[model samples]
Target: MIKRYSKSMKKRDILVIAPQPFFIERGTPIAIDLLVRNLDNFGYSIDILAMPIGVSPNYDRIKIHRSLNYLNAKELKPGFTLKKIILEVGMVIKFITLMSKCNYRVVHAVEESIFWALLFRPVYKYLLVYDMDSSLVEQMVNRFRWLKSIENRLESIESYVCLKSDAVIAVCNSLADKAAKAGSKNIHLLTDVANLREQANIECKEDLNEISQNNKIALYVGNLEAYQGVTLLYEAARLLQQDKVEICIIIIGGSESDVQYYQNKVNGDGLKNLKFLGSRPVGMLEHYLMQADILLSPRIEGSNTPMKVFNYMASARPIIATDLNTHSQILNNERALLVPPSSVAFVNGIKKIIENEDYAQRLGSAAKEYVFREHGIDQFRRRLQIAYDTLK
Candidate 1:
């Protein structure tokens, strides 16, 4: 029986198409790294075809092919950008050439790369695994308001990808539900973990007391997109200016332009409690997180949980996040303070965390425990294994 069962198992060769520049210490890239790392450990040979940017880390049984770089940009951030679209066209051509020559057991498409996988679906018999992080249509509409009229068309494309895929790896429950409704056969709700290998190793060079001027620090990580609720954070800071609490807002992430935009907004509002530390080294992230009295996730939209949320929970810092489904799924009143996406509510939440140290301590303790038990690397690996096993 063992011999017969073993006969069916063949060495797996997977082709992964990462739309974004690979090996970046960002949200989607980090998640992709975890998946690929786990698969490599299971003796799967992975060939990653990604944008010709980002650092490539060494991993056994893995090969990376970077697309031809036409643009001279050093970095490419997430979302729909002109350079990204241009690069994708080149990437798809390379993808086609690779698929024609290589024998892959499965094709793993990350986010927008699904369309490329779909383009070659008719020709290839390989299994398609969609690593669905966010709804492309939703993100497009959110970024470009004019695209709202064509939302249905975009969603139709999204539905097509889900229905065509053999397995859908959703980053959150909401995405899984959407995939289910779109007729996905195998939907795996594998959430993100706090993968901070580099960040954890960095030694702190600055003193927290000197950085915050002895004030209580509240940390906000991630990009400064409108959906990230950076505006709401600034609004809350303005409100906190008049309050008795001495909490300082330290934001870490964003392009120079985004940082300037928010800095001007904060200055115009006459708020002195906010500091925008734009695009710090990844190693510095843990240092700031460690010094923070509270971790802020004022995200106003999106379904998938932000990678920082897991990191925040693991930091044992009391979290103050919007009460929307995006955050409510991971956080509750016991583990975090859930507040509406409003300045007043956010101000109140901050006050609660600052004033009641006992409650905040309990909340932080609970959050850390929850992350260690549910959102660790082992759990992520096991879930990934189950999703792939079903395909076999």
Candidate 2:
């Protein structure tokens, strides 16, 4: 018989320090949701101390605690900003207060919040688990070139925290490798699974009509952050129009501001084939996926796989992603088309997929089968169980 996490400690309680929103229709929060639910299944109670900016999870065995939001921030803007830093400070304070009241058996910190866990480990001495979502050092330096001046210092801090943590749960293989290189005592790989649940809101008014008889609908989902490389899609679409291949690019989710920003760019540039439908209920993602002829992941930064790729794979829609490690780790020439991170290369990829319908369908079918068999919720739960057992 296998050991159970609930029996490892007297309290069977965990303090989860999630630096992001508590409940959001995004990448990290969704992963956190699965963890919380699975821990509940294993008879563990969780107290989640999160940023005061999202909907409460309101689970049975979980209590949601929000940091003091002096700014009354309703929603945080994407990327690292002054606001995010202020929120981090607030989370640190709240974490300290929570720890002082009750002694949790485990302190599970996600992403950058691992810093606070490391700082307070000596005082509390709880089993510390670092949930490595992405390389914060890489994100900071890539988004802000000036951070390059102190990149080594940042890496040192990250490595030091990894070394101190009891266990590091990496979201991808690349992150697990980084953890090992940083001298982490224990490392576990737990990747995000596809969210394929469909919603009842089917009456979405999308202008995805193939204007010409030869038009194909290529859908892209997720925030329109600069790192997402949304502009690359535009550049590729412009080139495709020049070549007279009408690939109508339908962007499904993003902030209102990001939607306007990209919409303005497309409008001014006279790129008639691109459409932005703003943010949608993630449940409606399956509906859009079913309607899409091709899926696109054009992220230009970060090695961690985009959460949307799993959804794309489950949708049975052929994916065309950048040839970077971000997609290479999950995709290849066999399951999907991998092109260099260039507009010209994406233009060629789109043409090839559209020209040969049989090849595109084969790629989609293989991707769907692979993900369902190897990356389903059961696999996530098993991996998470094995990771938590390390604490014993």
Q: Write the per-residue lDDT of candidate 1 for residues 229-314, one digit (tens) a residue.
A: 98898878878888756878889899888899988887887777898878866667777788899999999978888889998998
lDDT of each: 0.85, 0.85
lDDT of 2 by residue, 303-379 (tens): 79998999899999999999999999888888899999999988889889999999999999999999888788889
By TM-score, the best candidate is 2
Against the true structure, candidate 1 has what lDDT? Answer: 0.85
The whole-model C-alpha lDDT of candidate 2 against the native structure comes to 0.85
Off by over 4 Å in 1: 1-12, 196-199, 264-270
Residue 32 in model 2: lDDT? 88
How much does candidate 2 score in TM-score?
A: 0.94
Candidate RMSDs in Å, in order, are 3.2, 2.7
- Weakest lDDT window of 10 consecutive positions for candidate 1: 1-10
TM-score of 1: 0.93
